[model samples]
Target: MREAAVSPSPLSPSPLSSAAAPPARPVRSPLSGRLAGLWAAAGARCALPVAVLLALGFLAPLVAIFAYSFAPPRSFDVFRAFSLANYAELFSPSNTVWLSFAWSIGLALFTCAILAVVAYPIAYGLAFLFGRWSSLVSVLFVFPLFVSENVRLYGWVLFFIKNGVLDGTLKWLGLEGAPAVLYTPGMILAGMVYTYLPFMLFPLTLGLSMVPRDLIDAARDLGANRFQIWREVEVPLAMPGILIGMLLTFVLAIGAVSEAKILGGQSVIVISHDIEIAFTYAQNWPLGSALAVLVTAFIGALTLLVFARLDLDRLLGRR
Candidate 1:
């Protein structure tokens, strides 16, 4: 049987049809997408102020200091020439710059230790026990900050010096041979601890405050004692505050020349004092700049190390 011839339908496109597949949508890279998003979020107006401020306030000074560090001896003109002579002088046996650094660092560590030990309990009490009174106590703790550092330190000087208030008080009580704390390293450390105690306390209190009471209760319910709760729960939670406080105190202590001069006099030598001497007395701006750079670099490295170990977003409540 002959089959009926089939007709080709016009509706069906042929294999060579000109009709094109929908143009493939272009894919965007993550980096470009992020940049776009950032631009959109930042806008133009908001970014200008921040950028300008950073350039003028932060970058300019930082660049100036870095340049000045390599400037030639006795000159503040960083453009003159670059030299390592200033840094090299720090290592010279007679210079004692390294010793000054060691003393500064040692004092900072001691101050941090004292602050941690003393402030932690006060902060813990404020966070957990003070209740409505915590705010008032906190205000009191920071009251010393209202006064200038110089004034506060001088007050300590009066209290600690021989034949001063403290000695007079003891003598009034009929006690003899009161130890002379003035111009001693111990007095210097005491003054530093007193000066920066508020810095440590405030950060620690903030950190301790972040810890949830519910967690402590839960730990206790799980048969954890006070020490266990502290070690396993509280300490870990408060670590960010502790780190920040200690770092702040350490940085403040090491950078202060006034404290060493006023409290320790000529006996105690810190890096800041040496830097001051280099710039003011020796008229060696380059040497002072080198010391400043060294101190700043050391502080930056330490801060970076702390931040690296911490989940900063979480610590700052940004996450």
Candidate 2:
């Protein structure tokens, strides 16, 4: 067997060399790799400044308020002492602050309902009927916002006060004197509706604008009546804007103080007024902080619930 061994030719390849070799990978410089990573993250890096600004401007105050909320009632020793006394006091049976909460919530609800009904027609006109004049009408609506809210509210006070413009005009016209409608809950609600009407109208208009006219025409072609189209198509499409308008109106109305003060006088007390009293007149910082915390929590929870049901991608037109 040793004598039978044969010599291999130089052209013949070995078994190991018969298979194709894998290509060597190109090595990149560390600096280039680092630059690539930085470029990829450029957007997030750019956002850092805004994030810092928000943390400072918005979150910092919330953190302070939250910390103060747990402090002992009627004390400014924030972050030094922690107690549930403020909350306990608010929850106590004798506390009539609940009445203030009820008033604020009820007034806010009424304002929202009124604004929804009143703004819808106007919003519809703005979206579909006003045509080229829409911008002018919108500007007119926005013009009121530039004036001070307090000034506007005070003007209403003068107009509605006894022997003011209405009463004087009525008497001059040989008609019965104007009814004593000032300094009433009804007046406060009226003021709120007036103040928050624009907020509701604009959002509703935006939502209505999102609805495609072609789809509406198609629905009509399909024998869908006006009510059916509105219920099945328009409402579903414009829901985001409607919800946004309602939420904005509700939030502003719930925290209203000037309306109650300037119009309702002492007829009604809202939660915001109570908080102001706690912070200013009563000098109860903890109590104010607690009230603020509760209000914020309620709003946050409601907002979350709304957002949970919202199709954000659809609203944003990402889809």
Candidate 3:
């Protein structure tokens, strides 16, 4: 038996060799590597066209306006001459532009307050009560947007004008005629609320819809009242939409011109009206550009502030 024993063959595998072997790495071709890199950047590539369009349409105009703001007052030397005269004039003690700014800010704030109160109930109804009819209700709200704003405002004018629909109807029914409310600040505010109601409502509805019903039910089960549930669960969840709606309405209201012109009969001049005058009637393009720059700065700053506080990832559901 000792003589019959033989050494293992030189080429034979060891018992531990297979267990000690490293994993085989896949060999990647250059083409495959390039394709993978492209796939990784696919999202950016897809967004390139939209980015280009925004640069051209939005950013270019803003740049031009900013450049024009630094030009000499009442001058067309945009990008050719640079001066601080336009801005200086705006900040001068004699300038009444501040009045317009105050008016605009006041009106915008009032409009936001009014819309927030008016739209919430409607939004709540749309989100919870009008389940099957929500789409139809939304369409109804949207239908007015399809009509020209000026046209719709004019329709209101016809309805509110003396001896027009309201007054005539009241006289026919042997009641007191409609009050002399047209061509007033109250009227302008009314028009703004009417025009911006849908803007506030839709966003609120969207925000409310994002709130989980189960959480609401759980809160109710935990002895939470309707107000508590709203404050504790609904509001926190729907805050993003509410903020968006308010911001949007505020922006639109601040820029409103036609509402004041048509409804208030220019009883109060707003900043937008001043800008229009500088551009059109006064032919002071530089002044208009400077005013526009200031407005843009204010809006941009406020928007940035709001966005800084907003959790966009949560809003977008990334979290």
Candidate 4:
């Protein structure tokens, strides 16, 4: 009677007591599950269409050019097979190809340098000083777009002609004679500056504008002068825009066919003209393809080199 059945306490410590369980995560909605599946499927569905279009449109044409570069020249029975004739002709001292290339590169480099130097100050003025008038100035800078290129070229041709605006002004100013302004390197330079100034100005303006005023003011407060602040703060910050504007100008100048052709009076031959002659007059598709390919590769390389010099992280660094 005294020996009662003993039962273990329900609250006694168990194996799970010391080991805390992981917190339960909130369950996702049915819509979220469907959205995840849809997102995953999108790339697979779109990839083929995009790839096919690119391949057919751009890739195939480039491949064709490469293949044509290996093909025999038109009307030539000799060297009827693969040969390095096109590449060899590119460097032939007897031809204008290499000279044109050199001249083009030089002109492009000069133009970019000029644009950078000229635009930098204007950009600074617009960003800091001419704040209210920036928009109007920008519009005035880009207003040349209203004139057609054909008309502009012809107008310059007309103006630079004998007894035209330039000569008339020259006589009125007491100068004996005004030399031809069209078909000269000076003319090309003037045209380039006029056409591309906006390109330089806008990118530079945007880049300089992005430089935080707080950092600049802080630098000033810390006994930094204008020159020091520019060198240390503005330069590093605005470098990306400077590089970009220069790159665009360089590319535009270098690849120019029309400017040097019509405006140049066809007397000065550029590389693009050589390529055109190869394809059109000579009907030498291989040589044209080779020239085009080489020019494209060179431009691509130069652009890449310029891009590598810019440090984006540094530009966006904390003040």
Residues 1-319, model 4: lDDT tens digits: 6999876577775557536666779999999999999988997788989999999999988887777776665534333568777778776778668888887887787778888889899999899999789888888877877887667777877788789888889899998768767788777766667667877888798789878899999999999999999999998888887888888888888877777776777767778888898889988888888888898899899889988997766555543
Q: State the C-alpha lDDT per candidate.
A: 0.88, 0.92, 0.93, 0.80
| Segments of candidate 2 deviating more than 4 angstroms | 1-32, 40-45
Total clashes, candidate 1? 0
lDDT of 3 at 117: 87
Model 1 bad stretches (over 4 Å): 1-42
- What is candidate 3's lDDT per residue for 1-319, written digit by digit as tens? 3688777777997768867999899999999999999997997899999999999999999999999899888889987898999999999999999999999999999999999889998898999999899899999999999999999999999999999999999999999999999999999999999999999999889888889899999999999999999899999999998998999999999999999999999999999999999999999999999999999899989899888878889887888
**TM-scores of all predicted structures:** 0.85, 0.89, 0.88, 0.79
Which has the higher TM-score value, candidate number 2 or candidate number 4? 2
**Candidate 1 accuracy as TM-score:** 0.85
What residue pairs are clashing in model 4? none
Clashes of each: 0, 0, 0, 0
- Cα lDDT tens digits, model 1, 84-115, are 99888887889767888999999999999999
Q: Candidate 4's C-alpha lDDT? A: 0.80
Could you tell which candidate, 3 or 4, scores higher by TM-score? Answer: 3
What lDDT score goes with residue 25 in model 4?
100
Model 2: clashing residue pairs? none
